[model samples]
Target: MIFEMTTQVRVSNFDEGRKWYETLLNKKPDFIPHEGFVEFELIPGCWLQIAEGKPTEGNGPLRLGVSNIESERERLIKELKIDKFEINSRPEVPVKWGTFKDPWGNHLGFFEYLDKDEEKKSIKNNLERTFN
Candidate 1:
């Protein structure tokens, strides 16, 4: 039985949407084909794809629940060279979540998480990346 599959995000312009999703997602799209399209994983179960010259409708919200929201944000800011001005301050929303956007205008935000070891490591690494 297959446990993995990919979901493609459709859009009109590959470059335009690719930049948008990448900025919000904070990782490079896993694949690109010149004028064909660019792709990123929403997770192991889903993905976002952008193609050239095609019509794009709604921009989707890509939210993540993180162990340490501030650290994750800081990592993106420092490594990506995103200035402090580029980020939305913490607790952008109630219920324990901080919100922000990717370079292309997709909504990117992180929720507070407390049960994952990888998340803890990610937060620590991200914080270290940001500061030193």
Candidate 2:
């Protein structure tokens, strides 16, 4: 059974890539099993890997969930010096989101739920399922 998940985003330089991710994630990686690869355990069994190498074209906008999209976007701009990106929202949609590129052009984004109760419920359910 597929019980876990891992996603990779490549970078041309290990040092710069790792630093960028550190700033974005707001912490050091959980695992550095080798010289050029680093892993962050984003959730219980969910992993985000940053490996040093050439980046793939059209790879991803690896969106992460946050509590406040605008605040997070501002943090990214102030901390990482990212360009101001637009946050999109719609009445039919339950969340707001925005995307930005890392130094190596790896697409990354943050999304925030409009409904805090639903977001809390989803997080609790996901944690329970992942851990139990």
| Predicted model with the maximum lDDT | 2
lDDT, model 2, position 38: 99
lDDT of 1 by residue, 1-132 (tens): 554455454555566666655765777978775666777765554566666543433454546766567787787777555545333444443335655654444444676644466567776875665465
Per-residue C-alpha lDDT of model 2 across residues 1-132, encoded as one tens digit per residue: 889999999999999899989989998999999999999999889999999999988778999999988988989899999999999999999999898899888888999999999999989999999878
In model 2, which range of ten residues has the least summed lDDT?
53-62
Cα error of candidate 2 at position 88, Å: 0.3
lDDT (0-100) at residue 25 of candidate 2? 93
lDDT of 2: 0.92
What do the candidate models score in CA lDDT, each in turn? Answer: 0.59, 0.92
- Give lDDT: candidate 1, residue 58: 46
- Backbone collision tally, model 2: 0
Evaluated at residue 69, the lDDT of candidate 2 is 89
